[model samples]
Target: MPEIVGESLAKRLIAWGVDTVFGLPGDGINGLMEGFRRHADQLNFVLVHHEEAAAFMAVGYAKATGKLGVCAATSGPGAIHLLNGLYDAKLDHVPVLAITGMQETSLLGSRYQQEVHLDRLYEDVAEYNLMITNPQQMPGVVDLAIRNALIKRTVSHLTFPNDIQIAAVDEDPYAHPAPGTKPVSLPNLDRPQLAPGEPELRAAAEVLNAAAKPVILVGAGALHARDEVIAVAEKLGAPVVKTLPGKAVVPDDHPVTTGGLGLLGTKPSEEAMEECDTLLMVGTSFPYGKYLPDPGTARVVQIDADPTLIGLRLPVEAPITADAKKGLQGLLPLLRGGDSGFLDKYHKEMESWRADMKALQDESRDPIAPQYVVGVLDELAADDAIMTCDSGTIATWSARHWTIRDRRQYFLSGNLATMAPGLPYAIGMQHAFPGRQVIAYVGDGGFAMLMADFLTAVRHDLPVKVIINNNNSYGQILWEQIVLGYPEYAVRHRQPEADFSTWARGCGAYGVKVTKPGEVRGAISDALAHPGPALVDIDVNPNEPPMPGKVKYEQAKHFTEAFLKGQPHKAATLATVVRDKINELRS
Candidate 1:
C-alpha cells in the first residue's frame, strides 16, 4: 500500500505526542476518520454528541494538562459549531489545535453542499490559521499548527480540502535543512523562556519596595508561578487577591490570601483593595476595572508575558514584561520585607469573613442553602479533585466557597464566561487524568443546555461526578436584574421541574437527590463511591442571594424595591438578605 497524506498526518500528530482527539464524524472528514482508525492504537478519538462539546473538551484538556489540545470538525455547520468553545480557548489563552474539513478543491467556488469558508471563519479565533491544498504539506502543516498553538499559547486552525486528505504523499515537506546542514529529521517544538531585562525588574521592585501597604492580585496566567507569587506576597507582607479564574493559584486557606477580588470575592479582599497604597498584578487582565481601586489612588506594578496586556485594564506605574515565573523571580531579589501589620490586619478580617460565611452555611432553612451544600461538598471531595464550574451564580458560589487547596485544579470558561462548559470540561478533565476525581458544579440553566452529553461519560465509562444546583431558575440573571433596579422577568424555569438525578439514572449513571442539608455530604460521598458517572441534584434555596463583596446602600435599596414590586411574596427573604448585609457592614 502507498503512503497517504491522511496517514502521514496521523503519524505526525502521534510523533508530536497527541494521544487523544475529540470530534464527530461526517462525510467531509471521512478520509481523516479512516486515518484515525488506522492509527487506533496510537490515537483515540472521542465521539461527542455535538461539535461544540468537542471544542470545549479540547479547551478543558488543554487547561488541565497545560499542553496542546486537538479537536476536529467537518465542513460548514460542524466548523461553525466550534466557535464558542474556540473563543473560550482563545480568550482564556490556552493552547488548542482545531482541524476543520473543507469541501473538495474541485468544488471550491461551485457552491458545493456543506461547503464553508472555514479559513475565514476561523480567522478571529486562531492565532495561526492556514488552509492546506497540497497533499505534500500534510505532516508539515500538522506539525506547524501544533507548534504555533503551544508556543503562542493560542488556538491554531487547519482547513484541509477533502480530496487532498487521502492523496498520495510524494515528498517530505520538511526536507529542507538549515544553511549548509543536512535534512531535518525530527522537529523540536518547544516554548522559549521569556523574561524581563534587569532594569525593568529593578524598577518594578523599587515601586513595590517603596509602598507602605501592597496587595497582590493573581490571575489564571499565574498558575505556574504560584510559589513565586506566594513568596512575593510573603516578602511584601501583602494579602493575595485572586481574579475569579485565578482562584486556585494560591490555596484559599493560605494565610496571605484574602480570597477573590470582585463581585464574587470576600469582604477582606474588597477592604484590602480599598486600603492598599500599591498593587502588584501578576498574569491577569481582569476586565472589571471598577472593582479595582482607582488608578490614581493605587500605584500599579504589572507582570505579564504579553506586552500588549501589561497595562491594558489599568494604568501601570512599573511594567515588567515576562512570563509569570521568571517575572516574579526577577523581582524577588530586589523585594524588601515590609511591616507585617498590613497582612495581619487583613488576616483578622478574613477570619471574621469566614465565620460570617459559616453562619450562613449553618443556617437552617426549609430549603437548604447552596452555600451549605458547597461547603460540605468541599469537605467531602478528594483533596486533588479537578473541579470544573459553569457560569452564573454557580461560578460565584464555587469561586467564593470552594476552598481550593492541595493541588486541586479549577477550571471554568474564564474570559468567554460561556454556559454549558462545565460538563464538557469535566469530561475532558476525567479523560486526561483518568485516576483523579473530577467534579462539575453546574447550574440548572447550563445543565439543561448540554445534559445530552452525560451519555458520553456513561458510554466511555468516565467516572465524572456532576453536582447540579437545581434552583429551577436562571439565578444569576434574576439577581442581575434586581440589582440593576429592575423587576425580575422571564428568568424562572418553571413547570415540568427536572429531576436531574433521575434523568442521570435513565442515562445509565448513578443518580441521587438531596433536598436537605443533612443529605449533602452523603449524596456527594455516594457519588464519589459509585464506580461510574453520577449526578447529585441539589435542590437548594432559590431565595439565597449571591451578595457582592462590597454592597452599596443604593444596591440594597434597589434590590428591596424590585423584590417588593415584582416578588412581593418573597418579601421575607428579601428582608433577611438586607438584614444580613447590614450586619455584615456593621462588622
Candidate 2:
C-alpha cells in the first residue's frame, strides 16, 4: 500500500462518483494532472482548454445528475479563470468539488510562476475551501469537500501544493469512501414542524378549496416539492404555471400544467398567471414581479422552506414557512374538488398555442430555424433526455419549444444567463448520467467562447451532443438593437470562423455541419446516436427573433428612446396583437 497525495485524492474522488474532472492542466497543477493520469483507471480526467468552461461543466453535471461535480485548474490565472463559472454554480446552488494545484508550499509569499493565495482567491465562490497542508489530511479534506458541497449545495474547493504532490502519509488513508456516502432519501427534505399552526393551514386549505380559478406558480424550489405541488393541484383542480427555474417540477404537458411562465413563456402559461384569482406560489420565489400582474385582485398563498423568502418579494395572503411537501400534505387532505374544466381549458389553449407556435416555426425557412431544430430535437430525444441550455435566445427556444412531455430534464442559466455554459454543462450532465442521453443547446457566439472544451469531452468519451445554433452573430444583442432601434454593430464574431467541425474531428469527436434548415435534424440525430462526443454546428435563421414576454412596455419604450430619439411611440397596449391569441387558446 503506497502513501498518497493528489493521486490518492483523485482515486478517492472516483469512489465518490466523480468519474470526470474538467479543467486545463498547467505547470502549477501539472503534479495534480500527473496524479490524475496515474489513477486513470480509477478516475477519468477531462483536459479542457479553459478553466472557466471546466468549472461550468462541473456546474452543469451537478445540476443534471444530483451528484457533486468535480473540476480542477492550476494556480494563478487558471484559478482566476474559474471565478465566473464558480460563481454561477454558487448562485444557482449546484454542488461542485473544485480542485486546484498551486505552486510549491515554499513559494507561498513569493511571486513564483503561478504562485497566488488560491484559498483567498476562491473564497467568495466556494462554500468550503480546504488548503491541503500534508498528505495525512488528504482523505479527510477530499471527503469533507464532497460532503460539504452536497450538504450546503454550493461549490467547495481543495488546493494542493506542488511540494505535497507525492508526500507519503502514515498510510493511504483515503483508499475508499465510507458506506452511505450518498443517501437515497427523498430529494425534498421532510422534517418536524410547528404543526403548521392549525389556523394557518385551515385558512390556506379553505382559500384553495373555495377558489374556482387557481394557479400554481412553481420554481426550482418547487422541483424538490414536485409531489407536493402535484398533490395540491390535483386536490384543488388547479392548473400549474411554473417559473423557468421550476419548469419540469410537473410534466410540462401534464393536463394540469399550463406550462412555464417567463419571457419565453407560452400563451397558456401567461394567461393562466394573469387570469387566475387564487395563486399558489409553491416553493418558488419568482424574482420577476412585473410578470405577476397586480394579480388582478388575485390572492396569493406562498409555501417556502426559507422563512426569509416568504413575503420577501411581494406580500402574500398566506405565507407558510414549513417545508412545501409537508405543508401541501397537510393542506391537500382538507380540500376535495373535481372541477376538471380548469385543466381541460388549459389543455385546449395549449393545443391552439402549439399550433400557432408551430406555424411560426414552419415560416422560418430563410436559413435554419433554431426553433424548428429545437422541435425536431424534442422529438428525437428520449423521454428522459437531459438538456443543458446556454444563455441567450437558445434559452428562449428551449423554454418554449422543448416539451417536457412524458419525461425529460432541462437545465438553463435561469437568471444568471452566463454566455458559454452549455457545452461544459453538456459534459457535466453526461458525466453524471453516463448511461443517460445528455445534450447541450448552444448558440454560435456562446459556443465560440468555450468551444475548445469539446476536446475535453472527447478525451473523457462523454457521449454528449452539442447543437450549435450558428447564426453568425450574438442574436440577443441583435434583438436588443432591434427593440432599441439601434444599428447593429460589433455584436457579430469578429474573428475568422474557426472550422468547429474540423476542430472536433481533429479532437477525435464526430462533427456535423448543417447550413440548410432541412439537414439540421438529421445531423443532430446522427451525432446524438454516435457512441461518443459530437458537435453539430447548424447555421440558424437570424431573423427568428427572441421575443421576451411581448417586451416590457417600459423596456421597449426605453430602447426606443435611447436608439430612436424621435420615433413615434409604440402603442402601450395592442388589443389586436394578443386578442385572437387569447380567444383561440381560452375561448
Candidate 3:
C-alpha cells in the first residue's frame, strides 16, 4: 500500500502521545492540511483565530500538563507570528514542538511569494531546529523532535516543504516484522533524575545547619518537589517564599508560605529575605538580585539541575547540582532544625500580613476595589480550577489575593511576561480537560488586545469563564512611570471605556457587567453557572496602585511628585491607601 510522508509523520506523533494540535490553515501547506483530514479520526486540530494564539495555546497546554505541546503554522508570515509564544515556552523551560510548512522544493532559490529563512529565524528559540529534506527521514525526525523537546525542556522546530509533505514513501516506520525478524528496539523516554553525592549534600546541609535564620526560595523547577521542599523547610524551621512562577508549588494557606518575594510579592517574603542570614534557594534562579539580602548579609546555598544557573543571580556558598526533588531528599537527612524563635516571628508576621490583605478586601469602595474582586474569586472558584492570568497590573492582584488551594493550577507568561495569553491559555486548558473549570483573569488593556479569539471559544463550545478587571488603562505601566519619577504619557487607553459584556454577547456568549462592590460575587457566580463561554466585566478602580513589597524613599518621593504634577485627581486613592496603612499598623 502507498503511504504519504505527512501521514507517516502524523501517525508517529500519535504514537508518541500527541493527541491535539493548535494551528491555522493557509495556502502554503495544502499537504499538511490533507494529512490532518486523512488522520482526523486519530488526531484533533483546534482552529485558532490567529497563529500567535495557536502558539500560546500550545505553551499553555505544555505548562498545564508536563508533556510536549504541539503547534503548527504555514510558511513565512504565519511562522513568524509564532515567535512571541514560542519564546514564552523557551524562557519558562516548557517543552513545546512547533511544526511549520515551507515553500515547494521546486521553488528553492526563486524568491517565492511566501518563502522564509525559517531555520535561521528559529535558531535561538529552538533547541532542535531542522527542515525535513528527505521523505525517508519523516518518522525518524518526528520522533527525534519530540524526544528533544521532552528531554531538554525546550522548543523544537521541524519545517516540511509543501512538496515533500505529500511525497510517496514505501516502508511504514511501524511495520510488522517477518517471522524470523528480530524485535524492534526504541529509545527509552523515561525522565532522568540526578541526586547529589554524599559530600555535596553534606556540604549543603552544613551551610544551612550553621545559619541562624535560613529561608527557602522556591521556583517553577521545584513545582513537583513540593513535599521535599516543605520537608526541608520544616526541618530547618525556615519560611518558604515562592517566586512568581512558584506560587502554586505551596499554597498561600500553607503555614510556612510567605507568598512571593519581589515587586509583585508579599511583605512577609521581603521581610524574610531582608532578615535571613542564609538563603537556601531550591530550583530557582530568581532574577531580582536587589530584593535579596546583600552578599555578606546572607550566605547562599543553591540547588539546581543545571550547574551554570547555580550562582546566576546571587552569590552562593554551597552549590548542589541535582534535580530539585532528589537534591532535597539527599539534603533532608543531614539537616538539623534551626531556632524556633525565627520561625515563630515570621509566622506572626505572615498572619498579620494576611489579615491586612483581608481587611483591604473587606473595605468597600465606589469603583469596586480589584482586591475585593480577587478575594471573592478565591472563595467562589472550584477546588481544581485552572487559573490563567495576563501579564500586567492584574498579575499583582492575582499574586497577592488569589488563594491557590486544593492544588489548583495557576499559569502565566512567567519570564516572557507577554500580554493576551490569558484567554488562549484558558481555552487550551478547557480543550485539554473538558470537564474541569478554567478561568482567565485578564485586565482591560490585555483583554482588548486579543478579544478577537473570544469567538474561537464560542465556536468550539468551550465553557471557559473570563473575568475582566476593566480599569480602562495600562495600569502597570502607569504605576511604573509614577514610581520612576516620570510623567505618564501614551499609557492610558485614549478610547472610551468598553463594555466587555456587550462585546461578549455580540460574539455569541454570555456576558455581564458588574459596577458595584455588592454585585461582584453574584456576577461571578452567574458567569460560572452559564452553560457556555461567559465574560464578567467588573469596573475596578483605576486609581488603585499596585504596592510592591519594598518601597524606597526615592520611589515614594517620585510617586508623590508625579501625583502632584498630573495625578492630583487620585488624592482620594491616596487617602484610601493612608487609611489602609493606618489600619494595618493598628492591627
Winner on lDDT (1 vs 2): 1
Task: Name the regions of candidate 2 deviating beyond 4 angstroms.
Answer: 11-17, 30-39, 134-138, 170-203, 210-212, 224-228, 293-298, 320-327, 338-345, 494-499, 555-587
Model 2, C-alpha of 468: deviation from truth (Å): 1.5
The lDDT values for all models are 0.86, 0.75, 0.86
Per-model TM-score on C-alpha atoms: 0.95, 0.84, 0.94
Using lDDT as the measure, name the better of candidate 2 and candidate 3.
3
Residue range 1-587, candidate 1, lDDT tens digits? 66777777788788878899999988888878878888999999999999999999999999999878899999889999999999999999899999889898989999989878999988899988988877766566676777778877899999878887777766444564322212223333333358789999988888999989899999998988899999999999999999988988999889999999878888899889999999999999889887788878999999888888988988998998888899999899899889989999999899988877766665365577787778877888889989999998998789877887998878999889999999999999899999999999999999888788899999999999999998898989888988887887888876866888888999989999888888888888899889999999998777778988778898889977886677733765665576556545654
What's the residue-level lDDT of 367 in candidate 2?
Answer: 59
- Minimal lDDT window, size 10, model 2: 567-576
Better by TM-score, candidate 2 or 1: 1
Query: Ten residues in a row with the worst lDDT in model 1?
Result: 177-186
Model 1: CA > 4 A from native: 171-191, 575-587
Candidate 2's residue-wise lDDT over 549-584, tens digit each?
Answer: 445676667655544544221231122223324433
Full ranking by lDDT:
1, 3, 2
